[model samples]
Target: MPRPFVIDCALSFAVAVSTVLTSVIAGGQAEQSPPDWVGYLLLTVAAAFLVARRRFPPLVMVLTMLVSLLYFGLGFGTGAFTVAPALAVYTAITAKHRIAGSAGAAGYLAVVLLADRVGGQRDVSEGNVWMVIWILVIVVVGEVSRGRAEHLRAVAEQAARAELTRELEAQRRADQERLRIARELHDVLAHNISVISIQAGVAEHLMHRDPDKAHAAVATIRQVTKDVLVELRSILDVLRRVDEAGEIFPPSGVEGIERLAGRAAAGGIAVDLDVRGRASEVPADVGLVAYRVVQESLTNVIRHSRAAHASVVVNVDDTEVLVRVRDDGRGVPGDDVRAGNGIAGMTERVEAMSGTITAAPADGRGFVVEARLPLRRPEP
Candidate 1:
């Protein structure tokens, strides 16, 4: 059985035993008494009805009242039988049936007063006053119990909702972190691998015909690979200590565009970098986004555009930074340009920084990638 049912059974048995004992003791003291068995039967019936008080509080209260009135009418006892009905009233009130409980209490009290009047009992007003006081005490206690139970239930619901919110927030953060790591990996590896591939092909082609050219190509491959390894290590370090306070190295930003231009130059693309404003005044995160926009654009030019000459323009203002990369190459078909990872990655990064990126074929020839990043970073 459930614990509440067990407790109810125990309480019912205890009340029944106490009522029976009180009636037996009272019968011995009364001058004119009904049979002991009659008192025992009536009180037991009232107490037994209380076992279902939690499930049917109003009905139990009514039944106990009727049984108690019957006991009083039969002249078995008055005081002892009141205990079961009082407890039933308390249960009914605690069950949140306040109107019914109050009405039942009032009717039962009136009946008790009428019985006293018929019995010619003295000090009837004083006795009724004491009965009212007792009922009021039980009502107060029941109200307190009801309020406490409601408070505890509300607290439990709030705690559960808080826990669920915390879980969802944690999952959201994890998903965002995973996406950031994937974007970083793609951006870091794609450009360097393209440079290495082009350099290796150059070295192979010139190996027999021109020894010096071949050696320079080999050197370029070594340099590009070394740079890639350094960036890879930094990315790995970030992944390992994501919760740490400081970065492994200063983030690559607009200042690193010259090195990016050099790498593109080594890959047989001549890159002209033009700066129009005070690039140094830009915030680190915004600068990083600007650098990435240029980097990814140049990588796309090297890998897809097949352009010999390209130009990178960076114009900074007090509020925002504008970056554009245009290449003089056989540009991509509209569909091919629309469906590429480089553009998607650039768009995601720019949007995360509350910036915007656009990639499209130029008006006459080649392709262009443009990005605008706000200088004042938003509060995280």
Candidate 2:
């Protein structure tokens, strides 16, 4: 059986035994007829009904009250016999059956008060006063228990909602971190690898006709390869991978745009890099993203554009930093050219920092990429 069933059974036994014994003792003190089997049966029924109090609290309270009233009205016993009924009414009140419990308690009090006024004295007796006190106690204690139960349930629900909010926040941060890492890898590999591809093509073409030029192209390939390794190591460092003896390479932000232009110029494309404002005034993150916007634009030029010249310009003001990279190549490709991931990555970065970017063909000329990065991010 359930633990509650066992407890209720024990409670019923205690009340039954106590009520019968007390009623017998009280009956002897009275001038009424001695206690009979009917009196014992009435007390027993009231106590037994308590066993199902939790399942049908209001019904149990009514049944217990009716039997107790019958027993008292017959002069079988009164004092301690009211205990079982009080307990039943308490269970009903705590179960939130406020109307039924109040009605039952009032009915019991009314009958007892009426009997007292009619039977012996017009003045209230000590027993009637005690009955009123018992009902007051049951209502007070039952209300307290119900209030405490409601408080605990509210606390539990609040805790669950807080946990769910924390989980969703954690998931959102994890997703943003993953996207940041992917963009980093794409920028580092695509730019340097495009350089190596161009140098390799130069070396392959000049190998038989001009050995010295071929040697220079080979040298450029070696230098570009070394840059790739250093950039890769920088990325690995962020993911907690460290080389015991490798040289650390700090990411060169806007300062490296000059070198970027140099690298492209060496690949036979005339390039110009201009800075119109103090780039250092902005946050490191803003500068880094500006650098990437330039880097990715140049890589696209080296890989796709058939023209020979490109220009990169960066302007910083108190509010925002602007980056513009234009190539004098075959203007933006036709409809047949499939889209590239670089533009999407750039857009994500700019928007994440509350910035804007545009990449399209210049009016009647080559392709142009422009991005405006804010110095200070806004509060969410």
Candidate 3:
């Protein structure tokens, strides 16, 4: 399933297959030359057992080393140079079962020397130095293979852990994105829907008493509801298919201020909009920040303010876009405004875009939210 596991499995399979094929060839040689086939057959069986050496190292070593002794007993000198048992020793050592490997090594040396003494019909003093040299080579290879396998396994484990961390981080980000979309939908549609619902009920109650006046109120409700649905769908479409091309638009720029004014007018909050300098000079992201600042400010006015009037001013200089929203209302409730993350969130967005926001109750009356956003994208 994962890369490291897949690679390890393939490598282990290859090693096992290779060991079996090599053992069959070495086993055939023993059968052809030796008179006592029993000892040679035992050596062949031991070598074949090496295929599962890693999974059952200590057992494989004991069984294979005993077979090696029997082959030596039957006068089979030197040869296969039995790479299989050497592999078994390597497996045992890598698994940190070095004591088992050491025991196998000691037993192998004893058998080789004893065989030479018995078969040659000679003294122990006349034993071949080459047998000792071969044993040393086996030990060296075993140590090297053990170290390599350990290093490879450690690296594989580290890689798997890193991959898992990345996957978890991606999932966390996806969850956060979903929450962002939900918050936007709730903030934008909920307030407007509340107003429309109340106004619709009022119009229904006055239908017979004041038909013409009631008709105007009903029309306003329809217009307000339609506008909310259109914008709601626009926001949802952006959330549902962020990956799709052509879904993007210039959001929260000069056009956004006009839309904000229109929405406030519909909600019975008279707004005066003032624009200065080049309106189109702001970057798209900065424009979006400007839009959000105005949007949140107006939304707060409708929901929290007692005053029926607000003023919006946009100043686009050479380097920055400054937006100011002032309301002639009993200044914003400190605790509610602070507890609501809207203002703080607006500041965060501005800072992320390399900008700043300041909000305070005006000197004599009402409240003001002013934001200065850089026209250029921040350096990466």
Candidate 4:
């Protein structure tokens, strides 16, 4: 298909045509002239088969070889017809037909010799044999070069596809991270900001009439903002890489319940925590999810309930971790299930860890949230 191959094939055809015409012209002038035109015609057809060598090599090569043998038997110019078998030799090698190619070459030589012997032509020389061998060598080398080029092309295409796949995967991961950040900002930061805004307005109104209580309200706003900063940092740290050397913080776990309880207490929601478990053995990711579920559940209670006190009970066993949060306040109606983002977020976190959550009010009292998470840890 290349310019050089096209040129070469064209030239070979022209030569074969010239040989046929010359043999015909000579035979017309004299009866002893070799009747090699038939051989030249067969050789020309065989050489042209190279055009489809890449697409159907085995079939083309076989047909061409058969024509070349017939040409040789008819005593068409041995020299020109020799190109046919030689070209077949090249195609065979190119098609990775080592045994077939070699065997064909040997069979061709045997046929040429046997034909000459059977025809009683004892004057045939060995120069033709040398010429055919040289041609075969050149064709074999050309086929080798072509095979190498094809291999290199395949490798380049494979590498390009792999690179494209990697880039797409990376882009998909970035999009997912952005979605996660948006969800966290909407659920956690937005709720905290709303609470801070309402409390700040109350403090401003009470400043002249109730100075001590106003001061206490300002302190509550400051503490809430501080807690917001810590959580915001946790989210941002994933992007900022504050700790270049390693992970920034040990993952928040069941042990973190105490701090979470203290924060709720500071915000005027008395929270009592009773932890019973081998909290240290939980998977970091699962522990984080469990802790967030409790934190978010308590946040909802503080924002929605007029309950004076909330209790969190953590029970960890060999197979699973169970969390229960109950409050003593106005209860939801049995038939009226009020669904909110807080409950949805807790459910999402628990489900992500192969866990389940149940939300309902305690008998004749307040709301209760419970989650059960399976225990599965990766080896360090």
Please give the range of 10 consecutive residues that has the lowest summed lDDT in model 4: 243-252
Q: Model 4 scores what on Cα lDDT?
A: 0.71
List the global CA lDDT of all models. Answer: 0.85, 0.84, 0.71, 0.71
What candidate 1 gets wrong by more than 4 Å, as runs, is 30-35, 118-120, 242-250, 377-380
* Candidate 2 Cα misplacement greater than 4 A, ranges: 30-35, 121-124, 241-246, 266-268, 333-338
* Candidate 2 C-alpha lDDT tens digits along 1-380: 56988899999999999988887777777655556889888889999998999999998998998888888788764447688889988898889897788788888889878886788854447767877998889878987888898899899999999999999999999888888999999998898888888989999999999989999989988987888798888888878765557676655677667878877876778898899888666788888898889888888889888769999999988899999999888876655233889888999889988999988878887999899998999988
* Ten residues in sequence with the least summed lDDT for candidate 2: 331-340
Q: By lDDT, is 2 or 4 better?
A: 2
The better-scoring model by TM-score among 2 and 4 is 2
lDDT of 4 by residue, 1-380 (tens): 46856765675576467646655665555423466545555766766775655556566667766877776565554345565456656666666776677677767777666776787765654644675576667566856766797799899999999999999999999986786677566555754665576567668998999988888878878977887776677788768966545334335688877877776675567888998969988888778777877777777766777778999999889999999999897866656544666677677777767788988988878999899998974343
How accurate locally is residue 77 in candidate 3, as Cα lDDT from 0 to 100? 43
Q: Would you list the clashing residue pairs of candidate 2?
A: none
Q: Which residue pairs clash in candidate 1?
A: none
Could you report the Cα RMSD, in angstroms, for every candidate shown? 2.8, 3.1, 7.4, 6.2
Query: Could you tally the backbone clashes for each prediction?
Result: 0, 0, 1, 2
- Compare candidates 1 and 2 on TM-score and give the better one: 1
Candidate 4 segments whose C-alpha is farther than 4 A from its true place:
1-45, 55-63, 85-191, 244-251, 266-268, 277-284, 304-308, 316-320, 328-344, 360-365, 378-380
Q: Which stretches of candidate 3 lie over 4 Å from their true place?
A: 1-88, 96-130, 194-214, 239-252, 344-348, 351-354
Candidate 3 is scored at a TM of 0.65
Q: Mind giving the per-residue lDDT tens digits that candidate 1 earns over 168-279?
A: 9999999999998888788878988988889899999999999999999999999888888877888877788754454354358888888899999999999999988898
